[model samples]
Target: MGCQCSKFWVCCWDSEQKGLVVEPPSVENEENSEADDLPAFHEYTIDQLRMATSGFAAENIVSEHGEKAPNVVYKGKLENQRRIAVKRFNKSAWPDARQFLEEARSVGQLRNHRLANLLGCCSEGDERLLVAEFMPNDTLAKHLFHWETQPMKWAMRLRVALYLAQALEYCTSKGRALYHDLNAYRIVFDDDGDPRLSCFGMMKNSRDGKSYSTNLAFTPPEYLRTGRVTPESVMYSFGTLLLDLLSGKHIPPSHALDLIRDRNIQMLTDSCLEGQFSSDDGTELVRLASRCLQYEPRERPNPKSLVAALIPLQKETEVPSHVLMGMPQSGATLPLSPLGEACLRMDLTAIHEILEKLGYKDDEGATTELSFQMWTNQMQETLNSKKKGDVAFRHKDFRAAIECYTQFIDVGTMVSPTVFARRSLCYLMSDMPQEALNDAVQAQVISPIWHIASYLQAVALSALGRENESEVTLKEGSVLEEKKNKTA
Candidate 1:
């Protein structure tokens, strides 16, 4: 039997066995050498995953497209206080559980600083989920396209392109060459605000081959006919990303190429990025993008080539990503409002006083609450439970307060955001941050604009070691409080 051989592996005929034989590949590679240094990949039980995601709550959703997306991505915190991004596949996504595990574990073996590496996966019955390190800063699409404070700087854009190219190169070297739906949304920024390629795109979504979520015209031309993605197709998508960084818009590759051909660099560039980069630098990026957008997939530059081309184009290499993006650093302390200060200090006395002052004033406008006029036994029991919980909370008896509040909530006789908020604080005092966070979210659901609920959530999130989410929630609470004061 004739057999083939490669640099990594060998196949040969075994005369003794009278059959072809394949030998395991050599493990003498640097990537394999660093395996022990990487975080251990976990096989999470469905229960653990559910608890992490608060039973797949809607508020935890962090995907760009929300629930309408094919596979919804959620933000969650593990019992270990580590934040994670969970991608839950639809029921129809992975009918073959074994195949799903194989793919997830294969991707999990890969660890890179430029990628949001997969930490674990859960596949039990109809449920399928992938857990990865959570990125605190928002996605590239939000910063580049729908920016609120300021558009992404030219230096940051260059860094993003280079980092993403390096991510692709690393994945290719690890034998995972194809990436699906490589777009700005697929790029997320970490706590340091540095861009990283999402690892989720590396897994082949078995859902009927509709991979590209962008305009059909912008999709790789070959995918239109084949209904499949190849490594070169990934390059084509990268070209589109380059165009996006240039224009700060979703320009179809064909149109972008036409603009490049016409020497309309000025017109193609983002208005916000004006005066940032020299025309020479812009021309060089445009030239590279044009090659990646070539009609023939074979002509497209490989990931290594893309990395080589992008490395020289990088700017502000010495400046940290968070500083360049004007985002608050991990150690940076924001001025805290009175409520935030109390929460930070865990001054239960101050928090209790503040809640007492708030005193159901926001309750009068609550439309979700059941009418309190009913004299049924259930209503009386609900009121009595809340009264007892309040007394326990006042006395700092958090355990009893939690129990009483649970009874009141489970009875479903009335909707009291105040009761939920009190229970949340009690849970915080009880050292049950996850349950506290859940109750705080439930409070927000009952009263959408209540600042106290947001404040409690911030405290719970902080206890859970999710500082980024905590800061955002704290800011939201301050805003809502200000709005309420103005209305008052």
Candidate 2:
């Protein structure tokens, strides 16, 4: 395989023999050449990363453990208006900058729907950041064991198992099979409510002095004998994940196997999943898990075989997200904000600055339990006010729309960039430039990447006769709009 100067052959697997075989994917990847046409991995500057993640704010951290852990991950958004997860490695993780770049590139090249798609990397001096698509829905662990509402449905669990196995299958096919730190926490729900293996797992290669966190009880049997992990070890981990899916708890692999041996599948299954799966479904999955947890690593089935075993049990491709968690589909009842519709017109950088000035960032960092509770309590009511504002604004009644949006904002706990932007537009129409500017800034503070917020600010500035400032705002909005369009 080659990419101009980055010419290096990948170590492919012998699918027929299940052995190591060195084969260049250059020829084989010809049909899939579009994969290579993905956006180039940019070497982001540290400042860009800092702004994207709100300077690594404590609230941005999404990892289950240790903020001061050797490596930490934060959720952020790009100037391009993309939601991203930024993994920041401590200086000691890779003392050598060149080595870090090589490893980052190696892992970043592997892309698939089943895995988090790596967008780019940042290697400036000691700071190393790997940016990948952010999953809005939480991990399998949260959905299964520690759900906020209720446990995952049986259909969703079956789908998660199959999707994860297939993700592993895709990685193995790409000739990068040694996935580290594989667990339920590593499998996240994507935008479509599908399970996706985190691309961060790909970084778990044979690097020296690197150790991953996992419960000691679930260590793969082969790794106990040898310090190294082979492809089969990954299958063993996948088995653990299957157990997590079925049991909804971290059961020791040995204990789980014992329970399976007794055919106590009922004891092994999650009580929440009771009456959802048939005996045949339970048996098929348990049998597959048993094979995966084989003591002899060589006897363990490969990822491809695991995919085959799980596919037969797969559910419908597009299950509603609300159904998975026993929630109802409520989007139509509550509009997603007109600002979301005018997203392509805002200045992203100016919005970020507005947020930074207002002591807020994005959801992961800026939002808190109290704020969320307030939103949850008054969401429908807030929608009613915004809806009234929308109706008035549509009828060219700027005064009425401003009064409606003001009431929604005066609640002080509710957040809606659209309400702020709409109010600012009304203020401008009423020849109230100062009020328009204040509301425009508030809109940006709540939703930093929204383009329309900045556009409104520019209109307000020009009305106030701040020509130079208005020109700068217009240029920033133009740049943000161009980026949005290109990505679109």
Candidate 3:
């Protein structure tokens, strides 16, 4: 019987013989010995995988189908405190041990920033596990399909398209162009809020040399007929992803290509992108998607061409992925100057004495008791405005953030240096350097010793062409930071 799987992908299963079967190596796989020269990967033990996974505890399981599936994924932390996602495959997935190691070694040799890096593999006894860098934030499917708070913005969706293309370009450049079953669930957001394609998806099941994503419907039209995946098939899957991004919903690749040919781009575009992108941008993207979904595999654009096309569509350089995705920055703290940290831990008792002795007045001598009816009423309003500002800030609506923060600051019911710093940042983003500097100075005045305020002042001054003052302010901030660290 002929095996449809290419050697670059994986071995095909001999169901009648009840074992994995291998076809002759392709020209690509014949040269796969190059992986031998690559850096060595850790051959983790079954015991180690068990320990990291808390003996395969139920809570650690991350796979949607649980243990009933042929493969299960678990989230765990290594002894070195590095987090990881472990995929444990069924015994029947790979009947031969060396073939399993060879496949693992080849995949483990792959390294790219856009890839959810494969760290190690365990193939001891009946246990087979693959470990990858853990993504704290969830998958693209969650952000796009089942968005909770807000849908991904147009800029972000465009960025995701570019990022996915770059990832595929990198893999193809590295001679690992056989990335299978590419889809939304295969892309996970990392700790830095960047989307990365999971490398585990690159590993073939060995059962059939087939795509591993549970939803095989995402496969290209040719793959269904040929039962083989090529680089061109991956591009077809990529077109489906483009449709997912544009429409904010899954559309069959066949249907999507028809929509493209009919020039029904408006129906293909998500309503959320109503005013976000120009018609030219939409038309260009639709054209690209159509090219990717060409009926003939040879007609589709390669990964490099896709990358070239997407480079022009990207906007908002240096903006973090999470910001545009409308999700919280993953565990990243606000960038605070040394003074900001000091203010956060400032001795309230000492501050109170310093204020009384140094003639600092609270809200023009209005008592600081929150229980008072007058103060309580003002406090409620202040809290509400600050909350609104935070929501706006998370949404990257900087102009609205400034307005809400300004309202909170104007009330003066509470003394929050952070509020002033936030407004200063919004001002900077809105290209109002003078207002930014004013807010930064006000923040410093409110919390006399905060380093972030001085740092922000340096930024504002530099932006305003006051180089000399900016340098001085920067040095002052450095000194404050040094003092705080020494005190700590």
Candidate 4:
């Protein structure tokens, strides 16, 4: 007699002589259809499911059992001694059973390293179930923002970014589906710390006429105005995801739907990662994100280009700024100014006369150690060279000044800001604005808050016809100096 059960199963039994015997379960004769056309799935009755979930015990539930997408996820052991996650889908809204089946089919066909694999599904009578590969690490969103968990490290963040980019490329190219929703919540990590893109319930085929729903914060601005899902739109969402990952903060609950609407991006960044991230790299990322959020869809970069732009950033933890210019050796001094020479050479015999003339002490102790003397000699030489260079500069003898400055620069003596600043000025006087700009930029990089150096840079930049950039440089220099003063 056939077993009175709707579930399909393979029967197994222990024989008296043999250890065990495998046989097919008998079922009532019904009109047969082409089984080859349908996807194969092992069926389980409600009673079998109950046994697997330990009588539907509350403890077996891995996630909350409520009315929502992915309603209930239960970690249970099947009768065959295999562990799996049983996702119970809410059938109240899915009035058409065939639509649910098609969704499952679409998900099953997607095979990607960065994406979660759909194992199988069950659609018998009113009960709907989806079985997927169990991921123990759960979602990226929880780990990133949860108060109890440790924050994601820099390396992990980069890895997540690379994995996400690969997954998006995969979906758009091979699967030919638009992952309309690519958010932190949809990313899950495996035991090995590899990220997997999940939650394709909102995915749509590229060929389908149906459009994706607009979640303004995560949606591209163009799509928000006109509901359409393109590959560029997916890239926009990915960019936002990158921001959230780096920030390590979730969208605020109050304005969750309109999180991306805000123009002041600094407010959206995570306070924890404030000083940890590189300013230059952060600026680049923010710039990319802004482009992604552009109102015109065509203005955004394609996925391939986006990935290419992020390549360099992914390898390095932080972009290094040129902080120190060429360091001259210590004890170096520039040539004495014309005023110094005239006063020293005039040398009045009377102490009173010397004091009145130069306003200086006549009996000041001079450095006498041999090493000190040698250092003084080097300083005198450098000063003489600088004086010669200055004379050349005054006569518009740029080549002579360049040669003198080059030799003085090679002496390994400490060149003060004024000296380098003057050398840069000579370069400017020679109509070599590019070279002058280079020197001034180097000086600024070495000491961004140096007022004289910054001013020189502004002048050089103006000469180069980059007035806007010059203004920005001046503003940055002012800000840097102010910040230093405040800190001091």
Candidate 5:
């Protein structure tokens, strides 16, 4: 009888028949369109869904809704006796309903071995429900920490790692999957103990529209600066997940640096595994994890490379049958000995070699100017430090050399004539004429006898619109050079 729009609900009545008629694109047409484009269900009355979920009883609630984007998930038995996980979208507090709807539709289309399948959806009036295949074993996070479940065997953990990497790779290959808001809580373990990537609520398409909160421990610094989520950023998150799986401890934002600095394998290894897993493999995993957590995203491996690196480890060792058989687990702690450390180093080197052989660096090479800039900056920082500071400032290192020289000036360290002259050359190499003049001025103050510095200073000042000063400096330097040459 009426059609609803943002402004108002409209109904038309025929005076002759005293009947009401509604004229708008039929609901059936709209529903069919939604179904054809993406899987969506006809609106079921809220009463019907409430009944299906046993009146939204607490007992039926499988998991508590998340705080960032809250939604109630209930284990419901439909009238047809099909059991499902009913995710009720919280429309009241959500800022953009249409955007959320678009995200749900896009994520619903992603079907991969590592991804959890979207079953269907229900959009009835103000109530929106997403129906997904129920993950029987709950999330990997819950499985890992739940007292009722056994510790995840090392092999399974590796499988999960590889699975996640492959999923990310698949999403990236499609060129549609932007950044996944990944974390332990989003990884669900099925009855087969295989991990499925879930929680597409935060998923974004290639169009850069989503704004999700950052998990500081798992998110890389680059992602923080630019909203761009590279495969490397996902790899970083996976690496953090690997560490969490090993240690059985929640990695805090504060401890991230310590984990990298200490490289303590024992600190991250899961106590539940009782050190039963191979110490060598554990150490290797930890090292990779640390690499993933590198402050620089470029240092981290891509998801595809990470998958390749982890998959072989599974082949190298036999899965402990007893652990899989559900044996009475024992308590034993594995210590990180020198051998474990060596093995980890070997594994990392092997990964590097494999990556080199694959022409990955050649094909992808620091091809992006941004990547090159980051590399140059890192080189500069290293050269500036006292320990490795003396490395030659080659043409390649000129950017870094200039940066160091500039910093030296800012700190009032240009006391020596030699230092000032060197800094002047560095500034010249960097195309900074004004900076060169300043350096040359300091050099002349220290020792005006430096004819080369004077000449360079004149050139710099000339470039900087100080023609008079430039001429004066050049004449003085020429006279001094002649005098010195005659004396020699």
Candidate 6:
């Protein structure tokens, strides 16, 4: 193993493992070679992660279990427009800093198509976080239990099981055999709609001893007696997962076994999967699940054997997962609104007209009320800077506008969403999308309901090639504008 230690944290990777370590493995990743590859591990600072998640804003949180869960997960986008999922552990969760780093780095070495690979981690002061590939479609629980659109098809369920088994096999091959709390929630669908086992389940939270959150009757018998987890425990959990897929519910292991022994496949099988598979296929799956849930830990099927058993059961093998799940293909770009279209086409003149029409009306109430008695020379300088920025902006001198706007913002004499919006457009015109995004975000912070701020943000995001985010932001702007028009 190759180790890279910094003052904040330690990152290690297996030198022998070949392939570039890209999080959210892409289809084109198959062509990666040993010669042109970067290390699979990164050590991210807490600040970087905070910026990505917008200071851990409430809206960014995506953890299904919600506040009740020990750790919180947030959806974030990196500066490069790469989406990421960041898991922030409770302060006391990882009491041993060294242990947290070791576990994170060890897990970071793994990169597999079947896994939501760990990209990096942050261990600063009392904070401990793990960053991984963001899976857009959400967890198996949502689709399997709380689905709104349609029930998960039989082919997709079989694929999930097979892919999970493959993930376990891959992790075992890499000498990371133990996975904690392997449940439906641990399985998330990626942008391609393919099921991937979450890598976060691989590392045990040192401070949290009660690993299994489910009822003791459902937990592996060995775990109840020993208060420890083993590879067999993971197999037992996998059996529960299979039961979940089969029944579309959280049935206790003993109860499921009884139902299976009574030859009541009808009772155990999901109602929605009635006409999907043959009797033989159902029997084979039940038999596999029974073996996995064997009373004797030694009798459980290993991940390799499990994968072998599941391989033949996979149906519609050639179909893309997105099609099977009835989701848009990863390559499909969402249709943009008029504002988003203008932004994509870089129609600065059109954007300028919109800004001019909107004016600084949104900033009127937000600007600091400075009376003549309290006004200082510093305030005058700030106002002069803003005046200069507006003039340069009107003349299309983006560079000069950015400079003057920076001075005005630095003074911090007053808050103006309009000024920030103008500066954001100036940055976009100057071909600095990231800076433009930051300024636009700041404008929104100053005036939360300002439609112009959201519109500017959409343009900046589009320039950054974050089309999905841009579409959402542009739609938000349109909504705010409509609401304002109605109220007016």
Candidate 5 lDDT over residue span 178-216, tens digit each: 556577877876545567777453354223343345465
lDDT of 2 by residue, 1-488 (tens): 01111110011101223432232232222325434434666678888777666567665688754643567888875544355899887665666778878878887877676778787889887777889888867888888888877788778888888778777777788888988878887888765566788888777522463434677678787787776678888889988988888898899999998875555555677877767776556656666777778898987888777766676687654667556756434222222123332322333334323433432222333332354554574766775787787778766688998888887777776566666766786787688988987787666656655556666767677777776566555544554555556677
* Candidate 5: Cα lDDT at 137: 58
Q: Which residue window of length 10 is worst by lDDT in model 1? A: 7-16
lDDT of 4 at 403: 78
Q: Please give the CA lDDT of all the candidate structures.
A: 0.79, 0.68, 0.70, 0.54, 0.55, 0.79
Backbone clash count, each prediction separately: 0, 3, 2, 3, 3, 0
The 10-residue segment with the lowest total lDDT in model 2: 4-13
Which residue segments of model 3 deviate by more than 4 Å?
Answer: 1-40, 66-69, 212-216, 330-488
RMSD of 4: 30.1
- lDDT tens readout by residue for model 3, 1-488: 12121321121111212221232222122234422433347888987777666567665677675444568888865544356899988877876778888888888877666778788898887777888888877899998999988889888888889878878877887788987788898899886778889988888855568674545566777887988889998898888888899899998877776665555555677877777876556655666676677788887778777777777788886898878766655543444443433333332233223322423222332224444654576677888898998778666688999999889878776766677777777787788989988887766655544566667777777778777666556655665666656777
Candidate order, TM-score descending: 6, 1, 2, 3, 5, 4
- The residue pairs in collision within model 4 are 332-414, 334-383, 335-383
Q: What is the TM-score of each candidate against the true structure?
A: 0.78, 0.65, 0.60, 0.48, 0.51, 0.79
Runs with alpha carbons beyond 4 Å of true place in candidate 4: 1-51, 55-57, 64-70, 79-82, 199-230, 251-266, 315-488
Number of clashing pairs, model 4? 3
Better of 3 and 6 by TM-score: 6
Candidate RMSDs in Å, in order, are: 10.9, 14.1, 18.3, 30.1, 30.8, 11.4
Clashing pairs in 6: none
Candidate 5 minimal-lDDT segment of 10 residues: 7-16
lDDT value for model 2? 0.68
Model 1 misplaced regions, further than 4 Å:
1-39, 45-47, 64-68, 360-375, 391-417, 420-488
